[model samples]
Target: MTTEIATLGGGCFWCLEAVYQELQGVQQVESGYAGGHVANPSYEEVCSGGTGHAEVVRVTFDPAIVSYREILEIFFTIHDPTTLNRQGNDCGTQYRSVIFYHSPEQEETARQVIAEMANVWDAPIVTELAPLPAYYKAEDYHQNYFRQNPLQGYCAFVVAPKVAKFRKIFADKAKSA
Candidate 1:
């Protein structure tokens, strides 16, 4: 099966990583930093907003089962794309809503999804659609953060809600446990 990667940042990478991990077509999800100025940004540096990076997840999925547009649909549903550089109480450039498209087709698809999803929110969608400049895998501790620390405070309050929302909104697309 052919697989394509979608890199997205919608608030904390932990939230995005957790939700995407449950999607049916998804093969893997890696939490990382993207669209940043740093060569190898640490979680602390990115959190400080000096790297200009968004906490992102590089999702590997089989397009035969789930289309890229569908992935973006899940993305929009789980996070507030209308709010720039923030999701929920998390506020920082690192927490911005962004799609770092891997190709021209992916770029176009992202724009189309944003346009279609705009009507759902009172404010215009501010999700940045940009060609992926560079992606630096975050520290191993950040990967599968929710699953590894499900009872952690942030995971319980912030990440778990997003996963629940994804499961409810895209039940058909969710992976069978």
Candidate 2:
């Protein structure tokens, strides 16, 4: 019956945005920047690392339909948590794996998820489980990037494949949305 927001950064916002948007119980997904010191950073500023922002997706979801744990599971599966400050070809602190929790319970669940992943996976999870911060929404063009620009080069080459894989794996979750 309750709604919750989970802000995460694991890689390109386009990729994360595409994956989470199709999820069941997810009300909305906004691509943004967080865990940064600079205020109201522009996309260019964050890319330069001067803003210290990580590319993130702020997701609003119904907890009754999808638990926070399930969201975290999807997050961990969508990207490589072991690659510190990078995801695939994109390399930067801006692409770092992070979970910005709004409450103590979210923090605990994030930590537990990381721990469980570390045991099963060879590499230690480098994902940062941190307190939520002020998130600066990305530019308008960046919103719904994959859906709006499905045929665009980046969406086609970078985001679409990840999204396809996610949808294939999490088909049931998305179908119910």
Candidate 3:
């Protein structure tokens, strides 16, 4: 399998991690921080909005199974691309919508996808599509957050609904395991 990487930040990393983990082509999803000025910023620093980091997830997937466009499609569906620096009640710069493209092809696909999705929402898509600068894996506690803390209030209320939507809307693309 030819593995490709896609780094995305749309709301919390936990929500993105939960949704991508169930995708058929997805091999691994690492919750992290990206599209920021700081290097190796901690979650608290990101949350403070001083670090300028967005909570991101670096997904490893097989393009043969799911194209980069498909990944962007899922991303657009799962989060509010129209909202700037926030998702639902979670308000912060770290919760902003962004796509850190790994290649020229990915960059082109992301732009095309955003243009196509323009009619989907009344507001213009605010998702930042940029070349990936760097990715720092979040602290160990942040990895697999939803799976590890399923009973947590935020995971149950926010992340779970997103995951459910992913499974229901992309049923054909959902992983068997």
lDDT-based ranking: 3, 1, 2
lDDT of 3 at 115: 96
| Candidate 2 ranges with C-alpha deviation above 4 Å | none
User: Candidate 1 residues 5-116, lDDT tens each?
Assistant: 9999999999999999999989999999998888999999999999999999999999999899999999989999888888888999999999999999999998888888
Question: Over the stretch 58-108, how does candidate 3's per-residue lDDT look in tens digits?
Answer: 999999999889998999999999999989998998999999998898889
Clashes of each: 0, 0, 0
* Winner of 1 and 2 under lDDT: 1
Q: Report the error of model 2 at residue 13, Å.
A: 0.8
Model 1 segments beyond 4 Å from truth?
A: none
Please report the candidate that would top lDDT against the real structure: 3
Q: Which RMSD values do the candidates have, in order? A: 0.8, 1.3, 0.8
